[model samples]
Target: MHQLRTRPARRLVQLYAGLVLYGLSMALLVRSGLGVMPWDVLHQGLARQLGWSLGTVTIVVGALVLLAWVPLRERPGLGTVSNVVVIGLALDAALAVLPEPSALPIRVALVPLAIGLNAVATAAYIGVHLGPGPRDGLMTGLVRRSGRSVRLVRTSIEVAVVALGWLLGGTLGVATVLYALAIGPLVHALLPRLSVEVPAARAVQPVS
Candidate 1:
């Protein structure tokens, strides 16, 4: 709340920017013809199976994930709703403009770039502390209710998703493995540096 109440402009900008950049990062990985983020593996697989655009699949999946929150009693905030909408739109926009490269060197190089962008994007939105994205909330809620360790719960969920996505024909390459290895440390390093701290409210003095 203090965050919601004060310095509204910067937080909103950071939230939307981060969401858009997140989508762009997803697009870059997809275009690289290498691999994508974990949730995106599921989205891309669904799109291929369904003959839909990747962005459309992302939006639908995000909406569905948000719905899962209802059963978990997780609350959504402005950033959460915006995350569902804006990332999909941004993905579509970026993909429409970006040309998929054929060169192996360029494609391989995109992996690290995309990973770094993803980390910065993640730190920006999460640092705002407005709300967790739907997927993240689901993981936390499951952990809370199931009494599972965060590591176990998150790993189980991601492993299930990746296995399903791979079965459904999503790309799983060295890039996916690299992303898995690097993302944790990258965000860990970037979050504190990027987090937007809302200052405490000033106390009012009694009337003289």
Candidate 2:
């Protein structure tokens, strides 16, 4: 009990770190100017509307999405709620620190590094076991409730978000495609090595 209570704060730290790395990767990806991922597109769109940094927009979006979680009656794991807050803070910090690329040559050079960082971000993502992001969570929940195939549900959600972001002047390019293709595999690959299970008992259990 005592331990579980502490887990959320601890997880917040870990999530903050993860979001920092994720945000850094995203900034690099954006620098490449190749395209942005679905979430990034949305962040960029919101940033434009609000006249804020993309990172700030990220936090705002994440917070808003978290509001939906309360209604779903999904068990709000320590990681899940922490992720809702920390990702945005970390993203804001990372974006402020990482400057935009100044030239096409530099931008092109950032692609591979961006890809690798993105993979690292994926591991960080699942490490917390907070279920999916807000958008993903909504789609997944709908699929489960409706007994629809995950493929169709996921595709529809992705298409809708991408389309909406695009209409809002979000960047869409090779990087977006790259993120769609690569992030999943990277997460699958790294999950085994990086994951940590939550302690079964909050307090240290007595030895039998």
Model 2 misplaced regions, further than 4 Å? 1-14, 130-132, 199-208
- Candidate 2: worst 10 consecutive residues by lDDT? 199-208
Positional deviation of residue 149's Cα in model 2 after best superposition, in angstroms: 2.3
Whole-model Cα lDDT of every candidate shown, in order: 0.84, 0.67
lDDT of 2 at 107: 82
The sequence of per-residue lDDT tens digits that candidate 2 reaches over residues 106-187 is 8877877787886776576556554455655666566667798877887777777788878887888888887888777777
Candidate 1 clash pair list: none
- Worst window of 10 by summed lDDT in candidate 1: 199-208
Candidate 1 lDDT score at position 54: 91
Clashes of each: 0, 0
- Candidate 1 lDDT: 0.84
Name the lDDT of candidate 2. 0.67
